[model samples]
Target: MKNKIEISDLQVHYRDTSALNKVSFDVHENEILGIIGPAQSGKTTLLKVINRTLEFVPEASMDGTVKLDGVDISTMGDIYGLRRRIGMVLPLPVGLPLSIYDNVAFAPRAAGLRSKSQLDELVERCLQQAALWDEVKDRLSTLGTKLSGGQQQRLTIARALSHQPEVLCLDEFSIAIDPVTTMRIEEVLKTLQKEMTILLVTNLVQQAKRLATRTAFFLNGDLIEIDSTDVIFSDTPAQQATYDYINGTFG
Candidate 1:
């Protein structure tokens, strides 16, 4: 498989604290890379760093490299274009005041797509991909915030996909959802793996097992284990922290 994203000696610092310490890994094209860790373990920060959102944080600095498609992100002249190629789904569902259809169309418009039919095509494609069109089919004009929590999340996912990103960053996308809704989101994700590389930060252990092609375990802002999901779960040796956490010794 082609390398969709790569981290080489990656590190992030906030004042005296190291948020990510020399993290290194590669996400294959169209594969799922699950990031598992306890709260404040830098899981989210790592994603932000990769997506270049960390630059907005006060006193945040990073070292080494994050590459997408063999191109170092720091060297990319088009940060906006780079971001469009890497979509991010936040932990909380962020809905615009606009209607559901408009929310999904936002990115397309920002990307300079103006033809009504073109935007309509993207809207349908993204909503269907998010498993939301069927639910919102009759009410595309309704406010996205009016949907149930799960549906709102799916709407957010649809909004992220509007850019046709090569890589999708999922920041605990299912954390606020119920079990059944989480399952539906998982189904949508499974379908997504056919075209997009997913980098997921999740607290749910079972989620990684169910959807990840590979997994990375982080503790104290350091990447301790990264391997094929089968090996990481069943065969490869894990760090003591990962072992203890996975075995329920500690969170």
Candidate 2:
């Protein structure tokens, strides 16, 4: 598989604190790359950098190379375009204070898709992709925040898909969802892998094993090892820390 995104000797710092140190990895096209680590492991920071959200942080700086489709994102002329190509679903469900239909249609509308028929089709398709259409299809005019926690999380995913992004970055999407809904979303992700690359950052080791084609382990802001999911969870790994972390010894 071709590399959709790549990082080399990447380092990020917020003021005097280091968030990531000399990290390097590749996110292959049409594959789910799982990132597993404990809190403050730089998992979220990595996603923010890929989508260019890290630029918004005060005192945050980076030194390294990050490429998207063989092009250096740092030299890209359009910040909006870079972000539009990468959709992000954060841990919390932050639904827009708008109608469910409008929430799903927001991205396309912002992108200048004004045709009602086109917006309708886009909304339905994205919602269905997030496994949320049937439940909210009839209540398109209802407020998005009125939905349950699980529904709201799925709605966030649907909204992210509204732009039809080339890459989807999910940061602990299952945290707010029930196990049944998490399983459902996992299935949805498998289907989505056929259409776009997925970057999944989750603390759930088992979830990574169940979904990711390849897994990368991070600790103390360093990429310890990246390999097939099976190998990362096996009796031996490239790093003893990785083996220890996966075996429930310590995060």
Per-residue CA lDDT of model 2 for 75-108, tens digit only, reads 9999888888999999999989999999998888
Error of 1 at 81 (Å): 0.2
Model 2 steric clash total: 0
- Model 1 spans > 4 angstroms off: none
Residues 12-123, candidate 1: write the lDDT tens digits.
Answer: 8899988888888888999999989898789999888877889899899889998999989999889899899988999998888899989999988988999999898889
Write down the lDDT of every candidate, Cα atoms only: 0.87, 0.93
TM-scores for candidates 1 onward, in order: 0.95, 0.98
The best candidate in terms of TM-score: 2
